[model samples]
Target: MESTNNIIEIKIDSYDDLVNHIKGKTDKCGDLRDNFIFRGLSNFEHELVPSALRKDNLNQPIVNDYVGGDLGLLVLISNEDVKSNFLEDRVHIDLGYGKWVSFDKNQHPFFDNNREYLKNKNYLQIKRETYALLKFLNIADKNGLKINTSYETRSKIHNYLNPDKITFWPKKSFFEIISLAQHYNLPTCALDWTYDYHVALYFAVKDILENKNNDGVIWALNYRLFEDNYNESNEYKLRFYRPEYHSNPNLRAQKGLFTFLINPVDEILDCPLDQVICREIKNIGKKNKKTVFDNGKDLILIPPEITENDIIFYKFVISKNAKLDILEELYKEGYSEDTLFPGYGRVIQNMGNRVMLENIKNESDKKPKKNILLKIKNCEDIFQRKINYLFGKFNFNSEIENIYIYSPESQEIKGYFKANEIIKNSPNLIWEKYHNKSNWLKKDFNNYFKDNKAYAIRINGLIEFNFPFKINNLSMGNQFMYIEPDNTDINFLLNFK
Candidate 1:
C-alpha cells in the first residue's frame, strides 16, 4: 500500500485479499458503512472524469451517431417539406460535404466532412444537447408518441421520439431528467457509485474476463470527508446525489448513487475528479496543523483526529488473473446482470456476461464434443436480417459437424449451427438476399473466380448461445479457423442445447 496525493493505493491479488482490505478499512472507520461509497473501473487506466468532460474526438451528428446506434436504425427524414420547415434555421447546408445537424438552442452544426466543427462548441453546449434529447425522449415515451418516419425506422426508434409539434414540456426537474438519462446509459456528468462494495467489485471485474490484458480497479471513497466540509457556495465542491429509487428499480437493486462536481470549471477540464478532490484536501490541510502517521507493514494509520490529509480515497488494484474467479464468487452471491439490471432489454444487452456465468455454474457436468468454432462479423445484424445459419467457403473433410458462431464485437460465441449438407455454389435464395442487402457478402461473391468454386454448408437448426468465451491460439484474421476445445470450452459448447 502507498499513500500519494492523499489517495491510498492498495494492490490486491485475489478476491479474498480485496474483501479483507475492505473489511479492515470499515473496521478502522468504526463500521460507518453509509459514509463510504465504491466505484469500479474495468480498466485501471480510465480516469474519474465524466463522459461529457472527456477530451475525445466525438464530432458526429448526435441523432445519426449516438441515438441511431442505440435504436439500431438510421434517421433519414425524406419528406422535403417537413425537412425544410424543421431544419431551416436549425441546420446549415454543407452541400457535397457530410450532412449538417444541430442539437442545441444555438443551432451549431456538430459535424462536417473534416470533423472540425465540434471544436466550436464548448462542453456545456454538448451537455445541454444531451440533456435536451433525453428529456424529449422521456416526454415522448410518457405521451406514447412516435416520430414521423419510415415504418422500419419508426419501429426501431419509436421508444424515444416525438414528432408532434408541442410547446409543453414535462414537470420533472433538471437533475431528475439527467439522472434518468445517466441511469439508462446516456452520458452525463454524474458519476455512478454503489453503496454495496460487492456490487462495485462485480463491475470492476466484469469486462476483464474477455480482455485480460489490463488490471481492474475499485475506487473506495470516504464520503464523510466531503460531507463534513461541504459548502453550498463552493464552486469546486464535489457532492453526492441519490434520486428517488421508487421509480428506478435498477438503482434500488444496485444501491447506486452519483457523485457530481458542482461546477466543471476551465481549470479542472480533463482532470480526474479524485485528483481534484485530493488537491482541494491538500490545500485544506495546509491551512490546519499537520499530524504525523505511522506507516507499518505498508498499512496507513489514521490519526485520532480526522483531518483533510487523512486517507479518504482508496484505489484497490486487482490482478487480471483473478477476474474470472471474482466473477464466479460474485455470481454465487446473487450479483449478476439479471439482478443488477432488471429489464428484458438489459438482459439481452448483457447476454454475453450472463452466458459466461451460466457456463461457469454448469461446468461440472459436461462432455467434450467435436466442434468447430467459426468466427463471424456482425452476427447481431445478421441475426436481425432473419439469416438463421451462416454459409461460407470452408475446407472440411467431415460430412456432418457442429459449428459455433463467434462474434468479435461481443467477444463471445453467439450461437451454434449444425452443418450436414454441402452445396457447390451459393444457394440461389440466400445469394439473392445477400446480394441485395449485404455489401460485404456481395464483395466476397464478386472476388471469387469462376473456376474456383465456393461451398455452402447447409444446417439443420440454429441455436443462440450469446455468452463470453476465450479461445487460445485462435487467429482473428482467419474466417474459418478450426481449433480443439479445452474442457471449459467443451463444457460451454455441450451446454448449448
Candidate 2:
C-alpha cells in the first residue's frame, strides 16, 4: 500500500471526511449533485462515486466516463447568496456547488492600468497586456539585462509593437510571453490554477484569512476534457490552456496552469455570449437558412457545456471551521512560504507576514485630545441652491455609466486630459460641472484654465482634487462661497440668509 503522502492525492481520509467538513454549514436543500470528491489516488477522475463507496481506506480505484473520461475536479466556494447574484444568474448556473454560482472578484483595482483600460474591454485587454509585456522587455533590453527569450518571443513582440509589420507568431509563443508577464505582475485575463492540492489549499486559505467573512473555494476542472470538448463544440471559443513557461520559480513550485480567456467581450459591451450567438445565428440563417450540419443545431456563440454528470467541474467549499484545519495540515506537510517562495528575498518577504509587532497604540491613542481650533458647522448646506443649480445644468448622464461603457470619444478626451491636464472646448457634459465664474476668477487659474464666456471652465481637469470652492457661511463675519487661487480669495453670493 502506498504511503498516501503524495501531493497529487487529496489529504482528506475518506469521502465521508470531505462531506463531514462541509456538512455543518451546507443547507439541507443545497445542490450537492454538482459537488464530488476524488476517492482515487490521482485527483483526476470521472464519474461521481456514491458516498456509500467511501471506506476507511484513503486510496480507491478511479472510474472513467465515456463523455468526460477523467477531468480535473473543480472546487467552488459558495457566496451563500439567498437570491442569485448578477454573475450567478448569467454564467455557469448548473455547475454551482450550491444554489449560487462561483464568486466573481471582478478584477482587483491594485494593478496600475487595469481600471483604466482592461476593466470592461476583455478583448482589448489581451492586446494591451501584450503591449505591456513588450514594454517590459524593452526596459530590460535598455538596462542590458539578459532575458532568456526565444526567437519566436522576440519576433512576435517586435511585430506586436510595430502594428504595420504584419506580425505572425504562434499562439504558443504569445501565451508564453503572457504567462511570463503574469509571473511579473502584469494584469492579464488568465486565472492561475495549480495541480498540487496543497498549493491550491494555501492560496484558498490565504484568501480566507484576508477575507474572513466570506467562504473560500478550491475550483478544479479537467483541462484535457475541456480541450476535447472545445474541438467538438462551436459554441465556446475559449481554450483550456496550461502554459509551458518554466522561467518563474513560483510557477514551477506551484505546478501552475492557466485558463486563457480568448476575446471575452464580443462586439458590444455587456452583451452576453448567448445573445452574441443569437445575433450571429440570425445573420448566418439570413445568408444560408438551409445550413443544418449538427442535427439542425445552430453553431453560434455557445456557453461552456458544464454539467454535474459530466464531472468536468468540481468545487470544494471550505467553511470557516474547515479553513484553519486545512491550513494547519498544509503547513505540517511543509507547504509553507519558505518552500513555495524559495530564495532569501522571498523568504524575507514571507517572514514579514509572520513577525508582526503588537497592534499597540501609544499615549496618542488613549484619551482623546482637542485638535480642532474652531469647528465649522453646516457650512456646506449654505451653498445648496447654487450647488443644485450647477448640478442641474451640468448635463450629467442619467443612465448610470461606468468605466466599461464610457464612450470612445470620452476615453480619448480622458487620455488627452491625463497627458496634457487640460481639454480645449470639450463637448463632454460631465466636464460642464467644473465650469463656474469663481474657478475662472481665481489667480492660480493660469494658462491651464480653458474658460468660455458662458463661464464654462475646466480646471485641473485630469488630476483628482477636492472642490476648489468652499462655501463659507461666516468668514470675517460674512457669508460667501470662497475660492482661493495663489493666495487670492474670490467670494461669490453675499449673505442674505
Candidate 3:
C-alpha cells in the first residue's frame, strides 16, 4: 500500500492501477483526494506534476523540493500596488556550521503565498544559510570572505566569497549570480509575486540565469506569470510558452505564453472569482454581519488602480430593519452629489446611510444571509474610486478600534469604546440600529431627523447621525463648506436650516 505522502511526491506510471487505488482511497476518507491540486495525478490517468524549484527559507533547507511528502510547501509574497521596503536585490550566503550570512540590511523576503515561515525572514541568517548551501554544493568556497557584515552602500560579493574562485563569475547584473547557480545545476526558486513590469524585468533576469533547458520562459502575454507586457529579450532575455496549463500537451511548448492570473488560493471559493458579493452595504455602526476593510470610516484600498472610464458597480443588500441613515452617510461620502441615484426606488426604511436592506428578521435564535440586494455602479476612475470603496465596505467583520466620530456640535467628552455610540445625543433626532454590527469595535452613529429616521455622523467613515442624512460636500480636513449648486434640489438641501 503506497502512502498518501508518496502521492504528493513522485507519480506512478500506471493509469488504470492508479485510478482503482485512488477510487478505493476516496471511498474511505470522504473523497479527500479530489480536493488536492494534483487530483488527476492521483488517478494515474495523469502524468507528473512538474517540480517547482527548491526553497530557501531559514531553518528550512534551500534544496527542499516544493513537491515533497503529503503537501508541497508553497511560498507566496504579497503583490500589491503599495511598494514594499523589503523587496530588493539581496545576496544570501551560508558560512557552514549554522553561521548563515546575508548582504541585505534591514530587508525581508516577500513571499506572496502562504509559505511555511516563508512570510517571515531574518535577512542575515537567510544569506548565511543560502551561502552555506552554495558552499556545501561546492558552488562557492568557504575561504576568507567577509562572513557576517552589513553594507549600507553597494559592495561586492567578493567581500564574502572569494570572487577569484568560481566557474561562473559574478557580474554587473544580479541575474548573473542566480545564473551562476544554474550553471552549477543548483535548483533555485524564488517567491512568485505579481511582477509589475519593473519587477518582472528583474525576475526575468534571474530566471534566465538559472533556467537552462530552454523551457521557453517566453510566456504569452495572457499566460500565467506574464503581466502587462512580455518583452522579447532576444539574446540576453528569452521567454517561452510551456504547455502545462493548456488543453493539450502537444500544444504546450508553442502555446504557453506567460500571463497573470488571480493569485492562487488553496480553495477555489476563496478567490471570489469576479463575483464580489455585497453581503451587506451599510454605515460603520450597522449589524448586517459583513466584513469591514481598513481601520474604519470608509473602506480604503491603498494604491487602487485608477483608470479613466473604469466603471465601479456596487450592489448593497440590507435587511428591512437595518439602519438607513448609515447608508445615506456612506452614499454621501462615497459619491459626490453629481453621482446619479437613477431609478425611482424611494426610501422605504432608513437607518444612517445603510437603509433597511433585504428583510428584517426578528431577534431570532438563528442567523441567515440577507435577502435584499441593491446595486450601484460608479463610472470614472479617480473622480470617485467607488469600486475600491464598496469592495472595502463589504469587509465589515473585523471592527476598527481607534475610529472616532467627532461631533462638532457636541461639547461633551465622547471617547473611544469598543461598542459604538453617538457622541452624546442629538437635540432633535432619534437614533436607530445600523448595519454596522459586522464592525463592532468602531463607534457607529445613526441619528434620525424624524422619529423613525436614522442618520449616522461621519468623521472618516464613522456614521454620526441617525438619519441617512447627506451632509453637504465637505473636504476631509476642511471645516467650512459652501454649496453653490446649479439646481433647485441642491439649493434646498444647502439652506434647509
C-alpha TM-scores of all predictions: 0.50, 0.39, 0.18
For candidate 3, report its TM-score. 0.18
Could you give me the TM-score of model 2 versus the true structure? 0.39
How much does candidate 1 score in TM-score? Answer: 0.50
The list of candidate 1 runs beyond 4 A from truth reads 25-32, 55-64, 67-173, 209-212, 231-236, 264-268, 284-308, 344-355, 358-497
> Looking at candidate 1, what is the lDDT of residue 331?
75
Q: Quick one: ranking by TM-score, best first?
A: 1, 2, 3
Instruction: Estimate candidate 3's alpha-carbon lDDT, on a 0 to 1 scale.
Output: 0.23
Give the alpha carbon lDDT tens digit for every residue of 397-494 in model 1. Answer: 34336777777666677776776544433233335443443344555664652233344555456777555465554455566645454555555645
Residue 367 lDDT in candidate 1: 36
lDDT (C-alpha) at residue 459 in model 2: 21
Best by lDDT: 1
Q: How many clashes in candidate 3? A: 96
Give the clashing residue pairs of candidate 1, or none. Answer: none
- Residue 94 CA displacement from its true place in model 2, Å: 50
lDDT of each: 0.57, 0.36, 0.23
Q: Between 1 and 3, whose lDDT is larger?
A: 1
